[model samples]
Target chain A: MKIKTDKIKKISKSSFTIYGMVIMAYVIMQILVSTGSLSSLMEGLLVPLCIYVILAVSLNLTVGILGELSLGHAGFMCVGAFTGAFFSVATVDLITIPLLRFGIAIILGALAAAVFGIILGIPVLRLRGDYLAIVTLAFGEIIKNFVNVIYIGTDKNGFHFSMKDAVALKLEEGGKVIINGAQGITGTPNDSTFTIGIILIIIILFVILNLVNSRAGRAIMAIRDNRIAAESIGINITKYKLMAFTISASMAGVAGVLYAHNLSTLTALPKNFGYNMSIMILVFVVLGGIGNVGGSIIAAVLLTLLPELLRGLNDYRMLIYAIVLIVMMIFNSSPKAIELREKYSLKRLFTKKTKGEDA
Target chain B: MALLDVKNLGISFGGLRAVDSFHIEVEKGQLYGLIGPNGAGKTTVFNMLTGVYQPGDGKITLDGNDITGKRTIDINRAGIARTFQNIRLFKELTVMDNVKVGLHEHYKYSTIAGILRLPSYYKKEKEMNEKALELLKVFDLDKEKDFLASNLPYGKQRKLEIARALATNPKLLLLDEPAAGMNPNETKELMDTIRFVRDEFDMTILLIEHDMKLVAGICEKLTVLNFGQVLAEGNTAEVLKNPQVITAYLGE
Candidate 1:
């Protein structure tokens, strides 16, 4: 019984460390914002920061944990964003309570993205390495283009969806066009709060951290480390891969929901949910340390806020950001850094000293 | 009846018969060895049995059930687990995590339970860790439980692989070159460990090895393959003494 508790304690210790850091950062920021110490620009960046953190963490589950290269994460996010925004708009009159409406929209959005995950994962997961990455990249572009031309409106009869022209959908009296082709969804309720975003991040961390330490997570990691050995040990590779991918997509969908609600109008522009967005999320996972969930959160928050914080640099903001990214990549992956990390790890710091000790 | 029966198992890669007309019948609790020179297609036979490769010619029966051409994971769940010729431990994971991966199918909690950290999740996770620790202790690897699998010494890594294979609770275990890169003393220890595993677990084991001394020390029965076909089969000493086996080991 003691051993059992000890085992559980070990798992929770790592989780608490990460969760603690995130909570501390959250509290400090909240205090700063409330005390009027933080600038308005920094205050406005909070929701975007949370959304990127969620994306980085979710993408890490695939790229870092599962050891698969996925470049369609923003595609899943777009699915969630459009679906969530559409739901909020269509039900704006029926759902008087903003929180309840936002809640249902997020859930529906996550379900829609998960469905897309399954649809894409069935064929895409079969490809390995660069092929998989390319296919997913293509998938993101496809989704962005598809949503750009989509038109949806609601009236007394019901919802009308048209692919080509918004004018083709002749509606009844008092009908409101929710989604105008190329113009995006208008009048989405801005129900997302800093508190709600924090709550969602906590939820995402809970789900992802628990999954990473679970039995299924082990199977998925085994598949990543060695597929043949995993299969020979009775791990169903396809099943576990699909499970991780779908859950990752759903989490990104949650981020999408947050993003949709935080804005009065949500667009599927190339600049918003495009290939670059996917690559940016991947950069967060890579720079944060792959498979390191806590690292991802820190990286996401810092990277998201870096540009705004560097407003004085103006033209050099992006240049500095690029240099910082390159330097971080080198420091994170170089052999010397790895050795240093091994020597000075938190585990070693807290534990007893053994032989081969060098300062 | 035989616990595992394979008859006329054959596979060809690009018209080259990697393994052909292979046949073996292993009874429960038997320690069987398959020996051959380099490129004798010994590993191919193991692959075929574990469903890594579909045998084009024959049927495999595991205790009266036909499992030919089934998926690899299904074959394992049907009571066969394997180690690799090249150690394939989850290198980045801790030794305990490497073993816990083998206990995957044993956990009964739902995905939702795992995500939510419900009581059942904690219960099963604890059980798995405890069980994994016990297996590590058997191989004397409990002290290194937290060490990364890739950081272990080569011999310990080999032992960890066997320990992990055993964690699957398999009725039939396939070990491919478990003693590769080991000194003679380590190989002897591995022989004793194999013997202990068989007697203690009461499980059948099929091993592919080139180490004649280790094979003679532990294996009761032996089969020699050459050019993807069986060269001889009998008692380990008798098969080792066969001219065909000797010639296969040496040049023409």
Candidate 2:
């Protein structure tokens, strides 16, 4: 469906033009995939790339849009990932076709994440921004730990099957639950194709794009910019904050499920959904400029790829990466980067003007 | 019946009583002003009335309904919308979006509509845009609808705040210093705009202003608050001349 032009036009003209460029980039990606020259590592990176893009953009919904720091995003991700994996692993043989199993698993995973998101969102949402962030972060840890303690050995019939028996039963036979615990669930059907991941990313991007442009989304942003003002003007700060938090979590859950199944593992390691993951997502939002959805997606892709590109640094890899992060943080806080960006953009604008005159 | 009836409302912070035994009533469609010198508890009165603070002892009734201790959103939903004393516009959002935020109370589409991109959502959304544009146009701000609220000039920002509150479709609008930082010319324009909004919205307004001239010019009735108590309450002319009000303003 065509986006309402009025809202689209309301964004800066440069941003509106950039939207076209993004679409073209997506099209070129599709062409590259069909041509099949993209390397295996690049192809492998695509799913995580899409997943992180969604996580970063969605997390920004709460952190950036509602002006609340939500560190508990990974917790919601854990919930959704496990829930989806639980379903797909439990019902793998129930659906004969691999394609159908993949489709259902992803959808179920997203829905599972959304459900848990609402559950987690309601309680801590009443807190102020800093408190909300901390509470959410704790929650992610809780979810991660909770999964480890959960008993996943019993089948739907309540029969506790041994790991060997469960494996022999075949995924199609409605056998035992697959998430084995800290050891990790193996033999997870890898249905997360680049096509599916990209499609999901596009859907998330469009949804967030529409939402931030919509009236409700603006209300959330309003609450973010000046909560007291938003409240005074009859906008309920808590309600909008909760909406953003839950929505962000739900999308993160979607990403988490993609990640779990794509990797064909279901280990509920606390480290997997730990504080570092949350910070990584936050860095994506902050580096991109908090409220800019397109920028968030771009940052997510770049950050996800950065470490991989830095792999050649060998022993100095993490040290150099740490230096880069410190530099980014230093530049970020003081508006120097913003000033430079503006100056650069001005030059581009003037060049475009000169080009127009020449034409 | 009074549109808003606040009786004996008070709030205490530790041993200090911020608002004590304050009472006021506004008849439907009347423009009432609450004014006092600095630290006169005018804002505290507004705060208690709007459910920002639960009164230690008091009752607030709106249109014969008890709204005492209700949450701010509940109060808003029950037809009381207010602006803050500190100008709190959503700084980063555009001017049109700011007004649209006010219209959020009227947005009926569910999250399902949002996720699915339903036609009903689009229809409702389009209607909201038209209404937001109309509201902005009323205040002569439609041209700058895309500009961030913080980017607007001080007077325009004040106007935007009022526009946003108006979007909530409140029966009783509380404006906490609508003319706080305005120059004489801007304040005059604000006075006219306030009057226009009151008449156009068919709303009862209870505004807190320190400017006596504005209180006298725009408010049909005035309540003079001193030390969390109503020092005087009557029609504007009478209250402005009251000895207690003069002392509260002049500080004997």
**Candidate 2 lDDT tens digits, B129-155:** 889999999999998886767668888
**Per-residue lDDT tens digits of candidate 2, residues A1-359?**
34464545434354444456456766787788789987778878887887888888888787777777777777777777776677677667778787787777767777777777677667766666477766777787877876665455544555453434335433444545565656556667787776677777777766776677666677788877877667766676777777777677778888888888887777866556887787778888887767667778778888778778766765574465467667877886767775565456434311111111111
The residue-by-residue lDDT of candidate 1 on B142-235, one tens digit each, is 9888777877889899999999989889989999998899999899889988898998889899999988788888998998999999989988
Pick by TM-score: which candidate is best? Answer: 1
Candidate 1 versus truth, CA RMSD in Å, comes to 2.4
Residues A1-359, candidate 1, lDDT per residue (tens digit)? 23344445666777888788778988999999889999788888888999999999999999888888999899999999999999998888899999999999989989999999888888877665566688779989999999888888888898888987878778788888888988899899999988888889899999998888788887888889887788788887788898999999999999999999999988898777998799889888987888888878888887777777766776675577578789987897899987777667756311222224332
Best by DockQ: 1
**Candidate 1 collision pairs:** none
- Per-residue error for A336 in candidate 1, Å, reads 1.4
